[model samples]
Target chain A: MNTLGISVDAWAAWAPGIDSPNDWNAWLAGDSCLDEGVKPNVSFVPPMYRRRLSLLGKMAVLTAQQCVDQYPIDSSLRLVFASRYGENARTVGILNNIVDDGSVSPAAFSLSVHNAIAGIFSIIHNATEPSVSVSAGQETFSAAWIEAEQILWSQMENADRVLLVYYDEPLTGDLTRFTDDIQIPFSISLMLSKSQSNGESICLQNKRALDSSDSSLNESKLNQPLSFLRLLLSPEQMISTTTSNWVWVKNSANA
Target chain B: MSDLIQEIKELIIEVLDLEDISPDEIVATEPLFVEGLGLDSIDALELGLALKNKYNVSIDAESEETKKHFSSVESLAAFVTSSR
Candidate 1:
């Protein structure tokens, strides 16, 4: 209820091999395809810093860095990183170690937490500005967008831009049994501004889905961030995605 | 000793996810943790597991002498060779 309101000025996404806007456009159009063998090449991250990141963490950092590189991000920029399931493999690996050996690896314990990637980014950029980490079950990405809106409200004094990032990868080992079919890892970064830069001003309204049955229908569901990215690339100025309780609408002209 | 050292180097790189680092970059006798390679305790445990898996070697991971075994690629090779 306490939001000054904001719109995204720049955005970027990174999946295994989805590199460019044209690539994304092709993907959205279903005119192109991705090579499953291709994993995110986070070779841009220096070796000293790279070793600590988990597989998913590396992809998240890669996409976040790519977004910052393309946009105007500085020390003052606020960061909101969201993930539904973060470092699941690492966490599971730690648990397995504990179960089998009665101990967990030091790095696994240190890096298994939800905000580990965000912490890595902060250290890399030396950005001490306010940062928040969010986890909102099936609606993690949408929750991040809402938090970005709230960031604008809090930073009304300087009116600084908030870079909201959402990232997740599928769980491995026995934990896979509990999760839905999340085939690949993905990350999206949106640079939000209070002043509405020349980039598109998309409107977001939280509501209930028109059809609730289909919400839980996808066994191997399209990742919500991917759906949102598709909406951004689609010609339709308006589209909506449904979570269990909330439906997120992306409108280019509204608000 | 050289073969064991090379094997240990490969194990360290792969297990720790040291992507940009190649086996040739590691010095034979240099300290492995907090200095030459900048590895820490967790890496030690990971490397221990990898070594155990690859060589079926038993490691006294908590012992004071175990720290010496993990101190360098050369020491790790010695530990593995002696265990064998």
Candidate 2:
């Protein structure tokens, strides 16, 4: 067990099928196939602010809002946004425009950056805190946890919570052949708190730990966040992941 | 009474992704930036491009006259109709 297990004040996830936390909870209980096509009603975001957001951006911001609304944290808490493939479709469109003509749309170029979704979140919440964006290949989720833990431990004085928002849509172009069976879009926001008593409030699979690989778990290689969801639903206190060299153990935070 | 003004309002709403806001809700004379609709310079560029594409009206972005045209739906309608 990693000594840096942070306390989760609240966590909210949104995908095509997982609309409400209740829906996720229901799915965890027992369900055959998750019914798809539940678009996030981002009416909470003002129309002006919603102008340039793609589907992935909307989902990330919406889920982040859901987590913050559930357990209100300080407005100045540091944020970490993670995604395996960031705005792939928009980038593809821009490239196609470049090939057709010699120019790309300014709006597309501005919003196609890796941190665009995080920037949009900051704008909506009026957050003035530091936000870090991460993209670590297939291990983006694991990288985010590490970053969140670092932020929490390093800023132990006034900074108690770090909001970790992770989201990704499928890659565009002919790259679909390489991706796993995750066809739907998804996002997750977890408010990680520093120095707290913990008992299964939040558990994580550590990436840096050697010999901690668990081969029994049937993991989806493309969608890394699904590993966390499966761990959340597991009856066992301890487990391992299939595709990665990580082990999930019970929370062992000492404060 | 100009249908062009109403059409311009609908175009603005559609171009800006102003969901849930009807064309009638947008006052014809309100300023488009800062206080009125809170649109930024980027939006100005976008709206200008959209206007050029849809109406074949070239907007001189650097000219102060362009600012006057983008001020409201009425102004944009007048400019588009006059230019064509």
Candidate 3:
């Protein structure tokens, strides 16, 4: 119901075969497609710490690192990580272990929580500022955006930026029947600051406020994060996506 | 004894997901935590579970002897041998 203004200072995204800005630009133009069964290379991470990361965790951390590398934020920058299904593969492995032998690997169980990736990121980067992990089914990206905006608005003076990371992978094995939303594996990180005059402004709106026949409205075939990434990449001014109870209309601030 | 020591080294590598390091690279007399292999507490728990499952050796976490037994591959091999 409330309209908030913010600017994305910098952003970086990573998918299976999509790494560079050129690759994303090509993907946005439909010139290339995401290659399956490929994972992001995170060899820069120390082996001891890297061993603990699952593929989903690796994707999230890789994007976060790349985003921060572009903007060069200090350790004080707050973090908001959102995922529709956090570490699904690791969770499934633990569940299968339970069903098989009545014993679970302690390391797997320890890192199974939703906040594990965020915690690891903070530890690796020495970020002492507060961090929040969010998951709201299909509205994960939008919810995380709202959470970041709230943090900035609530602390207008001290908090200048919040790093928002969104990531998810398609459900595999027997869990694939539950949702038709996510079909790819990708992670997107946006470094958001308060809206500035010259920067690209973004505003979130409830879809019910607009006229039903508005021609600017476009539906997305991809999931929430990917759809939002498409909005970011394309020349289009607006995108409308819906969950069961909520329909969010995100558009350029001026549009 | 050497074969058991080699087996414990391989177990550490497999249980901790040490993808880069090989069995020969792990010194039997060197420490397994913090200094040598640089494993953390979580890895310790994981290795303990693995040892229990593979060797049927129970580890008493509260005991000081447990710490010594897990100090190195040689100590772990000795512990496993004695337990058997």
Candidate 4:
């Protein structure tokens, strides 16, 4: 068993296929999935970063806020953002400006990169700790987990905790051709600390694949972040003995 | 003057998604920002774009007078009328 495990977790997603799941109960139930004709209302959102952020950034920021509420961790906690496609629509808008109009908005061009979400997360949360954004195709899942584990290891030595977030949205237009296999807007956040409790805790081994019954479980079984979040919230699925996954809360303060 | 300001008020309400506030509720002398409708910097920028596209008013962010022009729907309408 890995010495450390995930502690608290939260998730959010855009599942046009499902209604009534926007509430917290449906999220915990893991019933969110995407279909079509579903778009988030950006108006009701706060106005601080609304001007600079697109729809994706708004969703990411909202999800991150929910995660902070769920875990109630310290503001000093570090954050990690993982995505398979980073601001693809924003990229298209800038590229189209350069190609069709011969001009691009400098602000839009700057935010089009993959790390924009991470940067926004830091600014929104007012965090200054070291944070990283990772993109690794299909291996994004394993790669992010490993990176989080490494950070946790270092933080543990210093006697601290870490926050990790995994999020991905569907690409629009031509970009969809490259990443249509998983079709759901999803984001998941996990808060890790050195604690153990009645909560499920399991050690993770081979990052390759979960070959047991857990392996058969669809990662995208539900909406992107919501599906993984359901697993985290569910006490029943907290510890996957068949696979190398676990979550435990320890009372001991010492790392 | 009243008709122009009223029309601009409606446009501002629509463009900014001010569901809670009606155009009629906005007073000509009241501030449209923190003191009145609680609009923030983002809303100001969006309103700036909509106004530029709808009217021929040119706004440069570097100018202090532009901020005063957008302080209220009345001022914006007056500015638009004068510039037009």
lDDT of 1 by residue, A1-255 (tens): 222335666788876667677888786666546655677777776676778886678778877887788675676588998988888888878888889978666667778888888888888887787788999877777788777776676636364688888888877899778776346677788878774433346545544423445443222135567776776676654444444443334434334
Task: Let me know the TM-score candidate 2 reaches against the reference structure.
Answer: 0.83
After superposition, the stretches of candidate 1 with alpha carbons farther than 4 Å from their true spots are A1-4, A29-32, A97-103, A155-159, A179-182, A197-200, A208-223, A244-255, B1-7, B48-71, B75-84
Models ranked on DockQ: 3, 1, 2, 4
Write the residue-wise lDDT of candidate 2 on A53-136 in tens digits: 898998999889988887665654888999988998889888987898665666787789999988988888787788999999
- List per-prediction Cα lDDT, in the order shown: 0.73, 0.76, 0.82, 0.62
TM-score of 1: 0.77
lDDT value, residue A189 of candidate 2: 85
| Per-prediction TM-score | 0.77, 0.83, 0.93, 0.63
Candidates sorted on lDDT, descending: 3, 2, 1, 4
Docking class of 4: incorrect
How large is the interface RMSD of each prediction?
1.8, 1.9, 0.6, 6.1
* Number of the candidate with higher DockQ, 2 or 4: 2
Model 2 spans > 4 angstroms off: A20-32, A99-103, A155-157, A173-181, A195-222, A238-240, A252-255
lDDT per residue for candidate 2 within B15-66, as digits (tens), equals 7777768887888899887868788887777678778878999878789999
Query: What is the Cα root-mean-square deviation between model 1 and the actual structure?
Result: 5.0
Q: DockQ: which candidate is best?
A: 3
Model 3 lDDT tens row, A152-254: 8885536878999888887866677887674778899999888865556676666777677888866776666776777777776777665532334443444
Off by over 4 Å in 4: A1-5, A8-67, A86-136, A155-160, A195-255, B14-20, B33-35
Question: What is the C-alpha lDDT profile of model 4 across A48-130, one tens digit per residue?
Answer: 44555665676666556666776654644667778777788878777776788575554566678888877866766667777
